[model samples]
Target chain A: MLQTLTFFALAGLVTIFALGTLVLRNMFHTFLSFLGCLLSVAGVFFSLQADFIGGVQVIVYAGSVAVLIVLALLLINHKSGDLSRTNLWSHKWLGGVIAAVLVGAALFGVIMFTHFTGLPLTGETAAIEPVPYIELADGLLNQYPVAFEAMAMLLLAALVAAIITTQADDKADKKAE
Target chain B: MEFVNNIFVNIADLCRALFVWLLNLLGLPVGLAEVAMVAVYWLGIVIVCVFCALFYVIWERKLAGYIQRRPGPNRLGPNGWFHTVGDAIKLVMKEDIVPDGADKNVHLLAALLAFVPPMLALAAMPFGEGMTALDLELGVVYIMAVTTLASLPVLCAGYASNNKFAMMGAMRVVNQAISYEVPQALCILSVIMVAGTFNLNQIIDWQTGNIWLVCLQPVAFVVYLITALAECNRAPFDLPEGESELTAGVFTEYSGMRYALFYLAEYCNMFVAAGLATTLFLGGFTGPFLPGWVWFLLKTFVIMSFFIWVRWSFPRIRADHVLTFCWKVLVPLMLANVLVTGVVVYLLA
Candidate 1:
């Protein structure tokens, strides 16, 4: 009973922060709310007993991604006056509505597809470890080695592409000079 | 020694037993009480972390003063033991300052973001065998991830301050943290491959009287030490709060308890980094005579003092140089260490 309550509380917090991220006028507040949402989602992960996932969410998303977003904003959009009245949804309400509908559809599809055997599982079902991260290493390294290798190859390609683009930009600047 | 070790280990079980007994007396099922008991365990951990932070700050100050050939905090209480206590009082009593045009909510939230990560990181850190708060399977990863979250608060504090120096400090910190994490993670991965598990206690067990990983994985140890220093934002890597140049860095606009909280987090982070280096490299909680927790504390403090020594003795490098060293030098070295360790472990296994 207590677990369920804590779960709802964290889920509600995530919902509130997610809405705040989208609804806030100021970009800075939007970023803060986004971080809050990310953290609350981590909290939800913790409540689900997926502690490893929770930690990764906070470390990668809340820590790196959110901080980078705010830092980029601070550097690129230094003047507060310039962002006082950002018309983010001025002419893109249709696009916003479409995105919202798509998200809703995806959520509905997930709810419909995934099996949710409501709480108080029988002995056999409840006996499972209730965590998936324990087998993630083996699954990634052995069971899905090809997929993992592909992902690594993609990352390496991206790294090479980034270096090439930056070097090319330097060359272009030198030539122009 | 056994008695002392059990005292720390039983704290969690004691809480559960006491709560279960009370819940039973109240004619309630003790099932839900387990969740509350977990909360009690966390409360204990947080309390211990705060006290440790206080003492560690004093020790760091005294150590730094000694290194500089100066008397450290002699006026507070008997060799300045109560110096941190006095600082705490002063901080609490001081006026809270919010710079004009600062983001009020984020300014307030920044302290919380800074303070919470180190405390949470404590949950995964084992003081002795079975002496962790959470004991998650991926204990090492959990600690690394939670500590990484600390950069967000630094970013928040800098951005919310609306000061250029604070922003610059935050930028430096974000870059330093993210860049160093790659090498740090690689170093840790090398250790994990050798230990063959992410459970910190299990890893320590691998080294109990056998051989400390520092002997087997000397290169990883060096990489881990350097990256750990960078990760914790300790000297040479403390460009985030570069006082000489950036003028107090991210906490430039912060005052009173808010500023103190950031420092508290910093000190606690130092302990966490030291504790991690101890657990991963030095055999954690393993010694000849004293209790496990005692050995753990001794090793962690020794590592932390080394960091303090380096902080005071070494000059801070330029920001670009720091990044270049991480990306160009440390990353390749760590990657090589990881590959070598993996091959050796595979052959031995």
Candidate 2:
């Protein structure tokens, strides 16, 4: 009973902050409110028994990464302090309404039949005894080695791209100097 | 991997038993034991965080000082042990100043925000057998998910500061975070695949007979560690808070206690990252002769010390260089590593 109440409370907090994110006039405030919404969403994740992913949501979403985004945003000096993108919201409200309607319809379609029968365990409480984390590690490295190789390449690519982007700016700054 | 999962499942059974017993007992009466346990859990987290942050700060400074061949905080406590504590006190006592035009509440919240998520993530970390704070059935998943909350507060601090450097740092964070997150998750999945379970306790258990996953998944371990460093924004990749350029990056406008919180959060983050890496790759709490908690602490600290060493040794890479290194260098390497692992595993089986 208490768990359900906490879930609702957290979900409500998320909704409220999300609404605030949209309604706030200040662009920065919007981001700030969105952070609040994200944190509460993490709370919802916790309520749903997905603690590991929830922690990632907090650290990756709320920690260094989001800070880096805001830090990037702060680097660009604006022409004015006013964050109001006049007429943009008014024009987009209909689009939002249409999106909301579509989303609601989709949710309505799925709410009635919560289970796709014959599927594996669906209940959050339906116990699947946790296999150890190392088994997963072994499976990756020794068992499913090809996928591991592919993942390495992916990270390498991300690194290269990040370096190139930052290095170009460094060159520009140095050239200016 | 099978053994690890079995162990975690067994441990979970015991935890459920204990919790059920406690709940049953609690249903009838309220005891100080419950409160003490709760306090111990949270307090353990807090004190450990405080000590980790404290030691990391002082340790980093001393390291930096040593590398630079200059004296660092030698006067506070012997070898400057109390330097961070003094600094903490000083920051706490300083005036809390809010910018006149900035939204006060958002700015205020941003300071405290970065500190919480890491602690929450810490809740599910397995310490040897049956020694963890909230053993989620989905322990590994829980740690990963809870950590996602941490990125937002960074963005919050940046935007609320109304500073250009902070904003740029925040934007880079968002972009880099999303990009790197994919690989981190994938690499983590590789570990999960081996164990056939997401529970961290199970992962640890899988290695009880001295079967550390690092021997088998060395490539995955390396990729994950590199990504973890980048994920934590350490050293060469720490563009967001690059001292030379950003003047403290997202934390520029923060002052006094707010700055302190960000500072504390930074070290806690570093510790958390190291802790997770140790848990995932280095056989969390699986050492000989020591208690589980001690083994866990020792391993995590050893990893933490390594990060500190690397930070002091390496020169800060350019902002673009940091990103490119991850994408072009780290990502591709990890991907190829994953592919090789997959193919080999299939053939062997």
Candidate 3:
């Protein structure tokens, strides 16, 4: 009973945070809202007994990536006037409608295809030991060793690219001065 | 032979009766005793998080003081043992400042983003046999994924403050963060060669009772520990908060309670990095006799103390220099370490 309540409460919070992320005017605040949504999603993962994935969600999505985005925004130092998401083309409402439709479709598909039909599981059907989420790691290393190594290589490239881009920008600025 | 069989049967009956008695006394219906068991398991987890957060702060302060040739805080209860508690109360009571034009909601939320990841990371960390909050199969990956949360709030703090310095600081941090994560995760995958499981408890078991991964995997340990320092953004790697230039970086605009929360999270994240280093490389609570949790805590505190020492003693490396070093040195070295661990594990197999 308590678990059901906790899950719904977290789901609601995620929705609120997601809304905040989209609608909040301040870029920084939007980032924070995104984080709140990520965290609540992590909570949902925990309730699903996907403990490892939950932790990763909290660490990677919430901790590193979200923070990185916010930090990236910070680097730009645009005034609210500078990037007032208000200046975008007039098709914003259409974009919103499309986003809403896509979300609804995704939800409907999950309900139709997944075991997550409206009803909660009875304890009898709640087969206890969680199916391993860690299979992703195994599948990554053993069956997909090339892909795994490639991710490492890609990250290496990201580092080099990030550095080269920043240094190039600095050099250009120096030349302009 | 009948007498011996009856003796075994009687022992089995006693065990069954005892189990029923235990269930009845546990405030659970007979069918839900396992749920009750889970509650008890998490109570221990709550205690570990609270205790570590509270004391680890004070310990870091002391270590910081010692390295700087000063007594950290000796006047509070018993060699300043309760100083952090006092600080907590002061922080809770402090009138938190929300700057004009600041989005109050995001301003508060930024601190939370910073605060949460370390707590989540702790759950996946394993101690001794049968000790952990929840061992998901993808423990290491989960931890790696959640580490992204640790940097978001800084960016939030910077942007929400409407300060250019904060923005510059956040940018510096973003660069540092993704750079370090690569080496850190690769190094851990190196160890995955031997353990064959992302479940931390299983990884520990693979390390314990004779074949500790650290002995076999020294380079991974070194690379992992260094990358962890960088990932945590501790000194030399702490370009985001470069006080000399950026004036505390993303945290410059924060004050009072909001500031305190971000401050606590930074120290706590250091503890997370240290704890992880302990688990992945240092035999992770595998020692003779002394309780496993005790060893885990002791090792973590030791690692944290080392970090604090280095933070104070070393000069902050330049931001560009940090980027150059991670790419030029740490990445290639750690990737090679991963290859070596995998090949060695295969050869032994």
lDDT of 2 at B62: 85
Judging by lDDT against the true structure, name the best candidate. 1
Q: Candidate 1, residues B271-321: lDDT per residue as tens digits?
A: 888999999999998888888889999999899889888988999988999
lDDT (Cα) of model 1:
0.84
Q: For residues B222-284, what per-residue lDDT tens digits would candidate 2 score against the true structure?
A: 777777777677876787887788888887788898898888887888787777777777888
Q: What ordering of candidates by DockQ runs from best to worst?
A: 1, 3, 2
lDDT per residue (tens digit) for residues B1-349 in model 3: 3343244235434554665678889765675645555555556555666677777778878878877889889988998888998988888888877778766776776776677677767767775545565666777777777666566667667666767777788777778888887887788888787778776777787778558777877887777777777777788788878889989888887877777777777767777787778887788877766667677778887888777777777898988888888898988888788777778778988
- For every candidate, what share of the true interface contacts is present? 0.88, 0.84, 0.92
**C-alpha TM-scores of all predictions:** 0.90, 0.76, 0.76
How many steric clashes between backbone atoms does each model show? Answer: 0, 157, 17
Candidate 1 or 2, higher DockQ? 1
Q: What tens-digit string does per-residue lDDT give for candidate 1 at A1-77? A: 55667777888899999888766778878887888899899887776667778878987898778877777676677
Candidate 3 has an lDDT of 0.73
DockQ of each: 0.69, 0.40, 0.51
Candidate 2's residue-wise lDDT over A36-120, tens digit each?
A: 7877887876666555446667766765454555555545636543445532355667777888899999998887668543212
Per-residue error for A13 in candidate 3, Å, reads 4.9
Misplaced by over 4 Å in model 3 are A1-22, A35-77, A81-177, B1-47, B64-72, B76-93
**Per-residue lDDT for B239 in model 2?**
78
- Candidate 2 reaches a DockQ of 0.40
